[model samples]
Target: MRVGKASDTDVEQVGTMREGKLDQKHLLFGEDDSPNNYDLNMGLTGGGGWRTPRHRHNFDQIRYVIQGELPYTETEVLKEGWVGYFPESVHYGPQERAEGLRTMVLQCGGASGQGYLSVARREAVNAELNKVGEFKKGLYHYTDANGVAQTKDGSEAIFEHATGGALRFAAPRYTDVIAMDPDAYDWHKSQDTGVEEKWLGRFTERDLRIGFLRLDAGAVYQAGQFNSIEILFQTKGRVTAGGTEYGPETGYEFLANEGPVQVEAVEPTEFLRMVLHTF
Candidate 1:
């Protein structure tokens, strides 16, 4: 799995057309920009000549504008920190812009659909962190509504903005290990474990899926089978995702596609586990 911030790696120039003006840097996938796999492409558009003729793809895109506003036909403009999910291809992009555009896009494999963000509809929803309790030795929040309070160790739940943000809760000082198990079909309550657990909650309408995880000192979620793809974010602590181990600064990611794997917390690990649906 790849770890580290999306900007850490130099963008690879896969192909460029029209003299480096409107070229597509192959972000995630291989060189071809072909089909059948997850591909993330970063688009650097030169001011004035940036355009992606109305088209569509066969996957979903989670686009994050890193620099200049990317002009799109859907709403005309998408600013930084602006995330838009477009299913497959719904006829969008490069409407018109005065300056250039740069974006970090996350595309899912075998995905189809068109989704967009209404640039005109930007609202601030007040999100709060319910710090139910303190950590045993560090900064882990140990208060779970589902589990019994005051047990050896408890779990904490913090809510982040529906769209995008860093994290609502910080990792407690003693949170040394991390465990993530995403339930796709069934829901499980947090159990009383001596270790601290941090639950990253992402709310949706359809189904409720949680990255039910926990972390303890010197503990590694030694490669094992998880319910869903384990997307690990190393906020603080030495950890490994898949076969790749990263440090505190490296934002490595690993995907456990319905199998067993190991995620070891080498240091005082503190990260966020995004539970797809909760509430």
Candidate 2:
């Protein structure tokens, strides 16, 4: 088990690999050797906001809007307090986010098991690619040996460069992005006293899940019951575990069948929880 406080994580400015100016706080990172390697991060859009072209990836992503709104496309927008599941191989976006938007995102390998490419590796390759080509407006512009100019998606370019092959996406399980409204789902009483749950959805054959958990003040809950990795991000209230106190924005990770960990609510608390894809 690992616990991460948002304040302890360093902030980084996004690179030119994408056409945007955003600050990112990477909170928790999984093992690089595993296909299920993942990164959980909080991103903030500054003054002019950020932009990403219409694109897709081989990995899955779950996004929750914490503040302001996210414009995923020119027409489709996710208002604050919304959750979206972006599955592998499904295209979305030409995003034009508004300033002061805050969002938390979890990026991981999907059911296809292609795995996730680390941001560190991507940035390193981007730097090398910059010497040979230029990234412009979410695309890479470069010249070929035949003396011809060509353009490729910047993300695809970096993946190919890093892996020494073309990036191939699996057949999409969902035709479009799945947008969810947590408020629309009613919380159900859990078997544990003083605990309630709202499970939004479960996806793919790998059984990736998205849900929320609530604990009343003074309630004690046993966590880490899932067959896969379980991650919890405090959305509100305070809790204590193993004599340590945790507040909002703090993250916790429990590995598969890692056994139970007791969490006692010092005050009424709510958490956004996810069970990563089973490998």
Candidate 3:
């Protein structure tokens, strides 16, 4: 198990096809050189009128709004504390926010086995592509070897050309976006002592699991071994694990078969946990 605090992560500016000056703090990343690798990032938009072009990624993404509001559809908005899931190849936005926004985002491979590219890597590729092609209206435009003009989805082109042959074509896990308000859900007590959980959603095909856990002060929780990738993000109070104390915004990743992880609540604590099973 690996534990870390959000304040300990380095913050960097990562430009995207979006319209804002965005900075991000990386919380966790999957194993190196693995197609099944994933990334977790905390993003903060600086400008008041930030926006992103209508775009899609090669992998699936889950985002939780920590602050501010963002438009999800023509008639819908993702307010603070809401969560959203964007499946691979599913188009959704022209997302925008009138004020600054802060969110936690998770990007991982889809059920079809398509790989995910890190935002930093994608930014580097976009820089190179910018010299040869122009990204406009969410599409990349350039002349082919035959001098014929061509246009492609900005995200698709970036994935194909930037990482060479690392990515493969695959069917998206879902065709539409999923959003939820945790406050509207009920928390159920788990078998674990002093621990209560609220299951958000699970995608069996992708082996994706999302949920929240609440623990009483001085409670001890044991995370049993599993053939999967498990991640915990502290949202309220404090929790100590593996000799490290973590507060809100902190996160931890537990490896597969990593024996029971002991987590102690220094106070009444609440956190979000996500798992991606291998089976």
lDDT of each: 0.39, 0.91, 0.78
Q: Which stretches of candidate 3 lie over 4 Å from their true place?
A: 165-169, 277-279
1 versus 2: better lDDT goes to: 2
| Among all candidates shown, the one with the greatest lDDT | 2
Off by over 4 Å in 1: 2-10, 14-27, 30-36, 47-49, 97-100, 112-253, 257-279
lDDT of 2 at 72: 74
Residue 163 alpha-carbon offset, candidate 3, angstroms: 3.3
**What lDDT score goes with residue 242 in model 1?**
60
Supply candidate 1's per-residue lDDT for 155: 13
In Å, residue 221's CA in model 3 sits off its true spot by: 1.9
Cα error, candidate 2, residue 233 (Å): 1.1
Candidate 3 lDDT, 1-279, residue by residue in tens: 876667989988765444556778988888644556788888888765566667666677888889988686666787899888787777777776665688888888766665667666788888988899887656789999999999877777787787676444556556678888899989998877899999889884656788888999998877746577788878889888879778899878888778688999999998888886464
In model 1, what is the error at residue 171, expressed in angstroms? 44
